[model samples]
Target: MKLDESALAATTNDLTREVDARGVADLIEFRMDQADDPLEQLAAYDGELPIIATNRARWFGGKASDTGRLDDLFSASRYDAVEFVDIELETVRAKEWLAHEFRENDVQLIISHHDFEETPDRDVLDAIIEQCAEFGDVAKVAVFPQNQGDTLTLLEAVNDATNRGIDVAGISMGEIGSHTRVIGHLYGSKLGYAPLLADDNDYAPGQIPLEKLASLIELTKNERVDGQVIDTIRSEVSVPKELTLSD
Candidate 1:
């Protein structure tokens, strides 16, 4: 299923809940590296949210080893439910053949880069994003913020990309940069990831619980509307058990 970046941001659930609280996520990024049996879990998922699968390598802040990593990813892409798959640009750049495989499968690709240390200069950031965009539908960059300025740089990158008609998800890690998670959409970020639970450590650097993040995104979006903000009415919808892979 196709996804709306803003709407998806508002309806995300980090942890298991009795009801599917968050309406829909921009895209549910299932960190396959953390799942013991990712394929099995995907096969059994009864949620309405579309998935963006990632099996990151340890070298790139993921637990999965190099061996079998691509194989597992290829298997997951075949699932009807997965809308996109996050693949590191480094990997695609080295193995150009992998990009061809993704294209043949008709899977939407997110070329991603994670910098745990510090943000880079605007020129450097532009170069990285440009390179990644050449290989995927969207380009994502996450950087560790050393100060508030770093966060501004991230926003600038997002804005620049958006103006260029490029879909980008740019985030700055660390406390001061946390606000970027909410404001990212304003700058044309196509995806925002937050855990279902506050303490869930699935992602590194910066993360807020799904509920809190959803609330914030809603408020921000509402504030942008010219009229008075009204309480968002909740809807009752059953979660689907399986998602069919599509072209």
Candidate 2:
């Protein structure tokens, strides 16, 4: 559940199929919003991987449209199997008490922001990370990049956040930025997500199958045996401050 290390999560709405991801994924991202019976699925879950519950909202490119999305998310957090909960950055900014609710329950939170259209300016993305770090355990940003330039901007933003000592998860969605999913961890993204299978539903664009993503991680880990890429990024990026988790 540590936000400082790289972890891969398989995205799925079917809790029963999570067992297939046992070796491929470090965790399971239960997309509650996408399920027909989210709470029932959670209650019946008996899987090996810890769950990261996400009741995504329609505004954030998800199917959930009800007013009680947060209510459902909080309900899921009470489950012992759920180690983390993902809340949209907008929701956190709008609801002042949500952060406290999660903290009181001792549940780890991932404050997330998603740009389904296109990647924003590097500074804008950095600001989003700053806001996310102020509220949640891990600051997660996902943007749809149109080109390599956009993808680089997303990476730079993550680097900037990491330099500031913010625990972050950054990714550039869509095919143009697909490579970022595999390499973003090197630049300080702590988490990556992919579908359980290639034929299975993808929660986001450019998400590789869990099996393929695992292979890429292994390949990269071996190639970067000295961990020089991460070390170099840390050395070059200025650390203005360390992110302090709320007590």
On lDDT, the leading prediction is 2
- Compared with the true structure, all predictions reach lDDT values of 0.77, 0.89
lDDT of 1 by residue, 24-133 (tens): 34557777787667878777766665677789999898889889999999988888777788899899999978888976777889899989889999999998999888
22, model 1: CA deviation in Å? 4.4
Candidate no. 1 TM-score: 0.83
Q: Which ranges of candidate 1 are over 4 A from the true structure? A: 1-4, 7-24, 224-247
Candidate 2 wrong stretches, greater than 4 Å: 224-247
Clash counts for all predictions = 13, 0
**lDDT per residue as tens, model 2, 147-233:** 889999999998878888999999999999889999998998899998888436668988888898889977887864667888999
Clashing pairs in 2: none
